[model samples]
Target: MSLPKSNLQKIIQVSCAIIVSEDRKILVTQRSASMSLPLKWEFPGGKIEKEESPEQTIVREIKEELNIEISMSNKLPSVTHHYENFSIILIPFICKIEHGEIKLSEHQAFRWLNPNKLLDLDWAEADIPVAQYYLQTLNK
Candidate 1:
């Protein structure tokens, strides 16, 4: 059941990476079956820790989760989404890989999809708006 306003859970602050290649492909990862969202697709990232800026969160999370170092090129405004059990403020970053190769430790799969094709995959609830916002930015 969704949280009642009086008993709301803390809003988790998360940082996500929209890793773009020189050729304009964007990297996305599928949540492992054991993950909360199961096999849904999303831009890779994790929770922001204490004392971390959203940019710092992206770099650290990418290294730990995707095994790569990244440099942020731009940041989208944070999007807050409420799921049945919790809520999140998802901060999205537009970035490019600076080093290392990917060796997924937590995801079930990944894909480098062209921007226009992002909507083709089933996305996590929290990611739907971020993806839509990104696509809107592209058309402008």
Candidate 2:
């Protein structure tokens, strides 16, 4: 049987973000044409499946979307954003890719960028706040 309608509606979405740093630059992934917001940049992640915790979801999603294995530790402040089609409660986490290669499966492109250059690209609505907060914290 399928999930109950109200239960499904209450299902909160979670995502993992690895501000994978090298020389103080962070990694960003561009959503593919098939995604909800095509070409819009976001931290790499996907839906948190049933029976999985947010941390588990992040690890699984990173492997599925980026073809990389990540070790997530320490949760960042979560962000809640509403979209035209659906609302998402994104749990941002600080993670590091401990293994695997950079492979873009669901995204079209990827970039390593510093905070100063982050504003140059159009970010996904949900990710805009995260990027802004990241910059603010970096500047302090």
TM-scores vs. true structure, each candidate: 0.94, 0.85
**Highest lDDT scorer:** 1
TM-score: model 2 vs. ground truth: 0.85
TM-score for candidate 1: 0.94
lDDT by residue for model 1 (24-139), tens: 99999999999998999999999999999888888999999999999988899889998877899999999999999999999999999999999999999899899999999999
lDDT scores of the candidates, listed in order: 0.93, 0.80
Candidate 2 segments exceeding 4 Å error: 1-12
Candidate 1 clash figure, as a count: 0
Across 35-122, the per-residue lDDT of candidate 2 in tens digits comes to 8889899988878898898888888888888888888656777888877657888888877778888898889999988769887888
Per-residue error for 33 in candidate 1, Å, reads 0.4
**Candidate 1 worst ten-residue window by lDDT:** 1-10
Q: How accurate is candidate 1 locally (lDDT)?
A: 0.93
